[model samples]
Target: MLKLAVCVSGGGTNLQAIMDAIDNGTITNARIEVVISNNKNAYALERAKKHGIQSVCISPKDYESREAFNQNFLAKLDSYQVDLVVLAGFLVVIPEAMIKSYRNRIINIHPSLIPSFCGTGYYGLKVHEGVLNRGVKVTGATVHFVDEGTDTGPIILQKAVEVKQDDTPEVLQRRVMEQAEWIIMPKAIDLIANGRVTVSDGHVRIHE
Candidate 1:
């Protein structure tokens, strides 16, 4: 079975979707080994508790330095023996060492379709706001392997959501989550767990 360590920040709607998908058998041959968050009070931890899944809180503030926090986080993940690290809504920038260790084993769900409102300073509702400001009729979510650079990994799956004529960032964000993010994130995990996904030279291929 593919063991997963889901990392999140803030509320965990995406994390909930992943749990739901696993429970519903949409994502087979895998189970969540842990839910981790930088924010202690993140609702994702509570959700994990309710599901009897182990949860941990590792904040940079609690450690002496960023390097210390990164080391601890990597150690924790190694202790769990996780096969995949899922970044559901994780707000923290992944450490370089962790990225090197995990490599393409780490995956992330971005709010935007990427290459649009991604990279530095674009996250959460800010991505939706950028899409709205750009007047784009179509916006979506992307699941990709986590590389050293932000959102510059091999894309796995993307599902587009339509932008409404009179939609605020909050409304658009919600719509995108429902129509895109929630769907593709779990789907990507399912694909990876089944050994259908492969990365070659910074590109992804899905086996038939």
Candidate 2:
């Protein structure tokens, strides 16, 4: 089984999708071993507890320095011996050490089809805001292997959602999450768990 460590910062809707998929067999050969959050009060922790999964909070504010936080966070992850790390709306910039340790084993679900309304300053509702401002006809979500650069990883899966003329950022965000993020995130996990995903030349190639 692919042991997963799901990290989240706020509402864990994506995490919930993964859990549901696992329960319903949409995703096989993987199990969430732990859910970690930088925010102590994150509802994601609550979700983990309710599901009887091990949950931990390692906020940077609780530690003396950023390095201290990073060390403790990495230590916590090490304790789980998880095979994959899933960033489900985790807002924290992953520590370089963790990235180096996990490498392509880590993956993330971005709010938008990356390279558009992505990168710094474009997270959560901001991504939808950008999409609305640009009046783009299409917006979507991306699940990608996590790299050192922000959203600059090999794309694993992407599903496009149409942008409506009357959509607001909040509404568009919800639609994207429902149509794209929720659908693709779990699909990506299943693909990876079954060894169908491969990275080459900094791009992803999937096997049927």
Candidate 3:
């Protein structure tokens, strides 16, 4: 089985999606080994507890430096022998050490079609807001390998959602999560777990 460790900072809707997919057999041959959060009060921890999964909180404040915090965070993953690291609403920028350690093993789901309403200062509701401001006819989600830069990784899968005429950021966020993020995230994980995902020339090629 593929052991996954999910990191989160707030509500864990995406984390819950993965858990549900695993439970329903949509994401096969995978298990969530642990859920880690930088915020001690994150609801993601509660979700993990409810499902009898191991959970940990390692706040950045507890460590002396960013590197120290990264080390401790990674140590927890190592303890679980995590094969995949899923960033589900994790707000912190991943440190370089973790990126080097995991390489293409880490993945994140961005709220908007990346390279559009993405990069620094583009997260959460901000991404939807950008889409609304730009009046894009369609906005969606992108699942990609986690690289050093913001949302600049090789794309794994993407699904587009229609941008409604009277949509607010909150409404658009919900729609994207329901129609795209939740759907593609589990599909991508399943593909990776089944050994169907391959990266070459900075691109992802999936074999079915």
Candidate 4:
């Protein structure tokens, strides 16, 4: 089985989606080996525990430096022999070393259609607020490979959600997240698992 490790920093709705997909055989040949969170109280840890998957907490404050934190984090992942790393609402910027170690094996589900409302300071409700503020007619979710840059990795999948005239950031976010759970993240992981994903020339190609 292809082993996957999921990292999270929030409620982990995406994590729950992946778990549901796995339980329903949507991801046929993979196993979720572990779920790690930087915050001990993150609901994702509880979700993982409920599924009987190993859950770990590695707080950033526990380490002296970013390098040390990343080194220890990488070591923990290595122990699991993780074939893929999924960032489900994980808030921290992955260290360069960890990014180098995982390369194309790491994937992240950003809350917005990236390259637009995504960067160092954009996340969660902030991204949704940006979208609403911009008066965009449409906005949605992005699933992409993780690079050293912030949410700048090659996109694997995206789904558009129309911005209603009266939609609040919370409502818009909810709509996008619904699409993410049912479509974006699962499709991206499927592409990887089926050997249809290839990264070349700074792009991700999903073979038909």
The RMSD (Cα, Å) of candidate 4 is 1.1
lDDT of 3 by residue, 32-68 (tens): 9999999999998999999999999989899999888
Model 1 Cα lDDT, one tens digit per residue, 65-110: 9989999999998999999999988989899999999989999999
Q: Give the count of colliding residue pairs in each prediction.
A: 0, 0, 0, 0
List the candidates' TM-scores in order: 0.99, 0.99, 0.98, 0.96
Which 10-residue window in model 1 sums to the lowest lDDT? 109-118
Candidate 3 TM-score, true structure as reference: 0.98
lDDT per residue for candidate 2 within 1-208, as digits (tens), equals 9999999999899999999999999999999999999999999999999999999998999988999999999999999999999999999999999999998999999988788988989888888999999989998999999999999999999999999999989899999999999999999999999999989999999999
Model 3 spans > 4 angstroms off: none
Per-model C-alpha RMSD: 0.6, 0.6, 0.8, 1.1
Q: Candidate 3 at residue 28, lDDT?
A: 100
lDDT values for all models: 0.94, 0.94, 0.94, 0.88
**Residue pairs with backbone atoms closer than 3 Å in model 4 (clashes):** none
Off by over 4 Å in 2: none
